[model samples]
Target: MSEAPFNLVYLGIGTVAWGVAGLKIRAWRRDPSPGLLVVALTIAAPATAFLVAAPVLYRLIDRVAHRGNLATLLVYLGITGFSAAAVVLARMWTPPKERGDAQVWDGATADTWHEVRRRLAVFAVLVPVMTVLFFTGGATAPETPLTFDTTFATVPQIALFLVLYQALFGFALVDISRVCFGHASRLPTGPLRSGIRLIVLGGLIACGYVLCKLIAIGAAFAEVTGTEWLSTALGPGFAALGAVLITAGFAGPAASAWARRRRDYQALRPLWDLVYRADRRLALEAPPSAWTERLAFRDLEWRTARRGLEIRDGQLTLRPWADPEVVTAAALVARRAGLDDEDRAALIVAAALRGAAAALNEGTAPRPREDQVPLPGLDAGPADERAHLVRVARYLYAPLTGEALTAAATTTG
Candidate 1:
């Protein structure tokens, strides 16, 4: 088959693939926002334009079809202008939101705006240069040009512009992937992330293809002998490679999402396990109450010199004048006829453990350190202080149920 026909076939396949991928991305995200749809359309629009235009443009160049330049330029202007407009509209329609707030739909808007601005800026610079070059009769040349300068001044500039345009478009696609797959909290925690990474990789490969195109253009411009082979071979080869990578990148995430929706958890279990393990590690080691554990009795001493409570032998001590409420609770528990001091101590330990565990589980605030010494009159005696310490310790070690820790006397007794 001729290169034109072959390219046409490739273009058709690419368009179909991109369309399917866009639909899949939409379904996977479960987002029907108009702004998101516009962004998605914008991402695929450049690729679609290039794919459709490639074969026709190649044929026009081969046949020296300068008559088509007007139409071609118009198409380029339309695509580029629409792309810029889509970006601007998407930005205006979607504002940035705080990160990790799942309720926010426009979390990625800022990044999207940055990416769009960059791509528009590139096109803004290149389009005028291209228009000037096209109007100056650069698109038409003999099969073998009379001189290097004639071909060099014309063909390569056009090629360079296409190369830069494709690269900028690819970069924008990568930005879209970053937003949809990277930070999308609604996405299932599995292949979606991997798929986004693959998309980014594919975008990089597309960028590489454009780089190769630039190199080819430079070689053509320099009139390097036999370099035509490089230009011809690299251009189609890189484009094909980029297409394949992008297809895979787009397909992987979509398939993964579908699998998750089908309730095929086992298929995505490994990825979920990794996330679960990471979250578990973060929670266990840094349970917010860890801050309270760091506050020592000495820290309290430094803040206030309440003579009633002191740290001695790693235990909190209370003076004899501590409040009766505190002393009575411990004394009542101590007086239980059937219970020895050891049994009373055991109850205190269980109560403390239960209280701390409950607090941790319930997400309650850590017990305040003795440093915040309740108003002076509220100060309990040594026994009362011991009771209070037990209660506080319980609050810390295990969460206390309100019912279990009713009036300090209940636990002490």
Candidate 2:
């Protein structure tokens, strides 16, 4: 594709991906994981450049500097984002107690961080010089006609300067990627695992661009001609590939979370149906009977929260029907069967609910007792609510729990 079409596609896709990653980062910031925040900022830099700066704003600089102005913006953005990525990678590579903030360069290298600062101080001075040299080194003649004066861009020192900058940048990109991929390899097939891998892949591709530029720099110093295509086409193609992958990587966690919520919401449906019907007032909205209501997958976090909320509410309403003796009686049967703690919880709930269902069917509202064997709602904290409910659902669905309840009932009789 031509420059206009290519830029538009890249800008369009990059803007949307970066925007999604930004929202995910913002949500994470509510609790503020320092490592995640650093990674978010790292993602934000490129998103800002591709969406905000490169697509159009670079034109303002091009008015004076002409051709290489957009590249200058890229270099600055790479510097900022890469530096943050380095910090995040370093923080993640270390143990938990070691990571203080990971948002700053100082946090990454801590005892040796002043060296990073000293280099940054020097970099602050060199950036302006490099930007000036890049623009002055000149551009390929516009395929159509003259917008600015076409100066020969084979300046030896300038080529070497650009090459050195790019080489160091490639080194950073690849370094962080190594650490990220190292950790990602150990993770299971999940969003976080996949995200890290994608980011690493992007970094590796980006390193190809930097390496190509470095090679072009060598040719420039050798006074050779006819390799501009390496810098122009190959380098940027790799760069585009890298940007797309990294953006997707940043978006992985949120997408994964949403998928999990959708799955869990559906998985709990059977139990939800039973308990909600037993106490219709427990539901937040109207009955989740409508097709749209049951299948709507948006607002997952809130839905997940409400699931736990209504579940606990239902469990509380079942309190009066909960048979303490059944829970106590089931514990003995569970012990004799060598059930673990989790299985014990499941069977206890199963046995009590069985007895409760029997009494309720006979048109008897069983009286509540103070010692109710802690049926399900006592430990209904937000963090583990989903897990708690899933256990209940598992027991409710399995015929084994019903059998366990029958055995307990027979033993009690």
My TM-score estimates for the predictions, one after another, are 0.45, 0.73
> What total of clashing residue pairs does each candidate reach?
19, 0
Off by over 4 Å in 1: 21-35, 54-66, 69-105, 108-122, 140-189, 259-413
Which lDDT values do the candidates have, in the order given? 0.45, 0.63
Tell me how far candidate 2 lies from the true structure as C-alpha RMSD in angstroms: 5.2
Model 1: lDDT of residue 261: 32
What ranges in model 2 sit over 4 Å off?
Answer: 1-5, 32-34, 50-80, 83-123, 138-153, 156-161, 181-190, 220-223, 280-284, 288-299, 323-344, 347-351, 354-358, 368-384, 401-413
Instruction: State the weakest 10-residue window (summed lDDT) of model 1.
Output: 312-321
Per-candidate RMSD vs. true structure? 18.5, 5.2
- On residues 1-413, what C-alpha lDDT tens digit does candidate 2 reach at each position? 24574467557756786787577586666757555666666776666656533434455555556654454545444555555556444544653244453222224446445544655565566566666665565543442111111112356535645655665577668777887776676665767778878888988888887777666556656667676667666866787788788778767766777787887777677667766777788887765666865677777777767876786676767767776667776777678778888777766776676566666667776685764556743575665668767777777746566666666667668
Query: Candidate 1 lDDT, tens digit per residue, 21-46?
Result: 47745543775654555545544654
lDDT, candidate 2, residue 187? 62
